[model samples]
Target: MNENSSCCTPEDSRHSGGTDVQVGEVTTTYKITGMTCGHCEGAVSSEIGEISGVSSVQAVASTGLVTVVSKAPLDEEAVRAAVDEAGYELVGQGV
Candidate 1:
């Protein structure tokens, strides 16, 4: 079997809109500072999505929440770096 076959079965793919299943993936939510608009959200999302192993990112300026999906838990330092690159501050992990 292919390396990814064990991660998800055909039925699982059907439920996810036919997207490839990410096995062993983890999700994290972080509180971000200085985001005030859609542009800010896009910037933060773009920066975080560029990190290795990151599969998806969602940033909400109104809530100051940034959710990240990746193959594993990301290093705090790495997240800080991405936030910094986007001209923002990583306040901390979300509650």
Candidate 2:
């Protein structure tokens, strides 16, 4: 088997915009501050999207929620750093 198949594969169900479900993947919702428009969403998404193992990101400015899909659970510090780089604050992981 390919060494990266289990986690690094780019084939993620969340990106398809379909109902299909994928296994062994993890999703985290983060509370973000300082987003007020689509541009803010794009910035936050872009920064988080660059993190290794992250497959998809959806940031809603109105809700201040940035959901991230990845092969494995992300380190909180990494997420915080990414958000900070985008000129925002990662409040914490949501419930």
Candidate 3:
């Protein structure tokens, strides 16, 4: 084995970052804060879309709700990071 090789390595972490989504797959909903317009929704959607497994994203600024569809369950932190990248805050799953 390589001197730097381990059971779980940085390579594994990098490769398993995003989970891919499929049609009619798993759906998850999250609550967000600081969204107040269509542009906000679009920004959030676009950022979350970059995640690997994400297939669809719908964000409602008025309701502060975001829905995501994916092939497998996503890492909450990843979702939070995407939202942060879009300049928003993830309040966590549900509503």
Best by TM-score: 2
Model 2 residue pairs with clashes: none
As for TM-score, the candidate ahead, 1 or 3, is 1
What's the lDDT of the predicted structure labeled candidate 2? 0.74
Tens digits of per-residue lDDT, candidate 3, 1-95, equal 11211232111111122446556688899998877766677777887888998777878777999888877888999999988877788899974
Estimate every model's Cα lDDT from 0 to 1. 0.73, 0.74, 0.73
lDDT of 1 by residue, 1-95 (tens): 11111211121110112235377989788999887766677677777888899888878777989888889899989999988887788999996
Pairs with steric clashes in candidate 3: 19-53, 20-53, 21-53
lDDT of 1 at 45: 79
Worst 10 residues of 3 by lDDT: 8-17
TM-score (C-alpha) between model 1 and the true structure = 0.76
Which is the winner by lDDT between candidate 2 and candidate 3? 2
Instruction: Please say which candidate is ahead in TM-score: 1 or 2.
Output: 2
How do these models rank on TM-score, best leading? 2, 1, 3
TM-score, candidate number 3: 0.74
Q: Give the TM-score of each candidate.
A: 0.76, 0.78, 0.74
